[model samples]
Target: MSLYQFGKNLVLVLFKPIYRMEVHGRENFPKSGSVLLCSNHIDNLDPPIVGACTPRMVHFMAKEELFTIPVLGKILLKVGAFPVKRGLSDREALRKGLKVLKDGEVLGLFPEGTRSKDGQLGKGLAGAGFFALRSDALIVPCAVVGPYKPFKKVRIYFGKPLDASEYRERKVTADEMTIVIMEQIRELLEKHR
Candidate 1:
C-alpha cells in the first residue's frame, strides 16, 4: 500500500470505533487498473469520509491553494491527492492525474466540481468525461450521504461501474457532453437518496 493509503486507513481505523460507517455495493468497484470514482459533493469532509469506505486508495483533485501549505502538500501528494486549478483548465493537474491512472490507480473526483452550498448536486465539469473517454477508464458512481455529526454514522453507497458506451467516438461540444455525463451521475445518486 502507498503511504497515503496507510495513513488514510490508520485514521479510519481509529475513527471506525466511534463513527458508524456503513458501505454498500463495494463489490461494484473495479478490482484493477485505471478507474475513475465520481460522486456528488456535499460536505468538506466528504473526501476522506468516502475514502474510508473503500478498500483501496482513491485519489481526489483538491484545489491548488491547498498544496501551498508545505507539510500538508507533501502529505497529500504522497497519498494520491493532486492540485487542480479552479475556473480554468489545469493541464498540469490533468497530466499528473493521467499519470496516476497509467500507474494502475483510482482517481476520485467530485463531478459537481465544488461543494454544494444547499446540499444539492450541481453540474459536472467536462474534464471528468474527457478523462474517462481519453483514458478509457471505468467510471464508478458513488453517493455519500452526510454532514454527519461527530460519532454519527456516515452512509455511503457505490453504484455499478458505468460503461462509457455513449462517450465512445461521439463528436459533441465539450459543454454539451459534460451535462449529459453529469446527469448520468446525478441519476445514479438519486437512486440511493
Candidate 2:
C-alpha cells in the first residue's frame, strides 16, 4: 500500500474503537475524476475523521502554520496536505489546490475556514467556492456531527455531489457558491441531528 493509505489505515484502526465512528452516504462519492470534499469543521480531529471515513485519498489544504513544525510538518506532507495561509488570499495555495483537482484527485476542504469552537456551523469562506469554480470539480457536501470525544459516537454524513457546471461559462461570485455549499452542509447536519 501507498504511504498515505497505510497511514490512513493505521489511524482508522486506532480511532474506530475510541471514537465509535460511523460513516454514512459514502456511496455518494464519485467513482473517479476530480472531487472536492467540502465539509464542516468542528475540531482539530475533523480532517483525520473525515479522511478515515472515506476510501479515497483526500488531499487537505491545511493552514500554513502547521507546515512550520518539524515532525508534524513532515507527517502532514506525507499524508498529502499542502499549506495555505489562513487569512490572506494565498494565490500559491489556490494554484496547488487547482492542480490537485485538475489531476483528478480528491481534495478535502473545510469551507468554514477554521474549526467551530462551539461546534456550530459557520459561514463558509470564499476559498472553497473559488476552487470549485476554477477546477470545475464536483463539490461533495459532508457533515461531521457530534464532538470528537472518546467513546462518543461521531457520525460523518456525505451528501450528494453539487455540480458546478452551470457556473463554468458565467462569472459567478465566490460568495454565491459558498452559500450553496454551506446550506447543503447545514441540511445534512440537521438531518442527522
Candidate 3:
C-alpha cells in the first residue's frame, strides 16, 4: 500500500471503535473511471471520515490556508490533498480537479462549499456541477449524517450514480446548469432524510 493509504488505514483502524461508523450504499462506488463523490460537510473530520470508508484513493480540495501550518499541512499534502482558495472561483483548482478526474481518480468535494455553520446540509455550490458536466463524469451523491462523538453512530448515505449525459447535449447557461446539478444532489440527500 502507498504511504498515504497506510496513514489513512492506520487512522481509520484507530478511530473505528471510538466513532462506531456505519456506511450504506458503498457498493454504488465505481471500481474505476472519473468519479465525483460529492458530499455534505458537517464537521472538520468529515473529509477523512469519507476517505477512510471509501476503498479508492480520493483527493480533496482543501482550503489554502489550512496548508500554511508546518507539520499538519505537510501531512495533508502527502495524503492526496491540494489547496483551493475560498469565496471565489479558482480556475486553477478546478483545472487540477478536472485533470485528476480525467486520470480516473476519485475527487471528493463538499457541494456546500464550506462546512455548514448550522450543522445541516446546505445548498451545493456550482463548482461540483460544473466539474461533473464538464468532465462527463459519474457523480455519487453522499450524505454524512449525525455529529461525531465517541461510540456515536455516524452514517454515510451514498445515492445512486447521477448520469449527466442529457445535460451534455443541451444549450444551457452555466448558472442554470450548476443549479440543476446541485438540485440533483440536494434531492438525493433530502430523500434519505
Candidate 4:
C-alpha cells in the first residue's frame, strides 16, 4: 500500500478508538478523476482528521513555512502535500494546484486558510475560489464537527459534490465560487452538528 494509505489507516486505527471518530457520506467521494475535498477548519488536527477519514489519498496545500522545516518537509512532500504561501497572491502555488487537478488527483483544501479560533467558518480566500473556478475538478464540500476531547465524538460530514461545470459555464468569479463552497460546507455543518 502507499505510504499515504498506510498512514491514513494507522491514524484511523488510533483515532477511532480514542476519539470515537465517525465519518458520514464517505461514499459521496468519487472513485476517479480530479476532486477538491473542501472543508472548514476548526483545529490543527482538522486536516489529518479529515484526511484519515477520506477514502481517497488527499493532497493538501500546507503552508510554505512548514516545508522549510528539516525532515518534516520531506515527509510532507512524500505524503502528497505541496506548499502554499499564505497572505499573498502566489501564482506559482496556484499553478501547482491547477496542475495537480489537471493530473486527476484529489486536492484537499480548508478554504478559510487557517484554523478558526471560534470554530466558525471564515471568509475563503480568492486562492481557493480561483482553484475551483479554474479547474474541472469536482468540488466536494465537507465539514468537520465537534471537539477533539478524548473519547468525544468527532464527526466529519462529507456533503454532496458541487459539479463546477455549471458554475464554470456561468463564468463566476473565484470569490463567488468560494462563497458557494462555503455555503455548502455550512449546510453540512448545520445538518450534522
TM-score, per-candidate, Cα-based:
0.89, 0.97, 0.92, 0.96
- Clashes (candidate 1): 0
How close to the true structure is residue 101 of candidate 2, measured as C-alpha lDDT? 98
lDDT: worst 10-residue window of model 1: 171-180
lDDT of 2 by residue, 1-193 (tens): 8888888888789988898999999999998999999999998888988998886999999999999999999999988999999889999999989999999999999999999989989999999889888886899999999888889999999999999878666778888888888999999999997
lDDT tens string, model 1, 16-111? 656677788899988897888888888877788778777678988998888999998988887779899999989998898888778888889887
Best by lDDT: 2
Clashing pairs in 4: none
Candidate 3: C-alpha RMSD to true structure equals: 1.7
| Candidate 3: worst-modelled 10 consecutive residues by lDDT | 171-180
Candidate 3 global lDDT: 0.82
Ordering by TM-score: 2, 4, 3, 1
Residue-level lDDT of model 3, residues 1-193, one tens digit each, is: 8877897888689877788888888998888888888888889988888898887888998999989999979988899899899899898999999998899899989878888887776767778878877886788878887678888888777877877778777856556666675666667667665
Candidate 3 displacement at residue 8 in angstroms: 2.0
Candidate 2 has its poorest 10 consecutive residues by lDDT at 165-174
Candidate 2 displacement at residue 71 in angstroms: 0.8
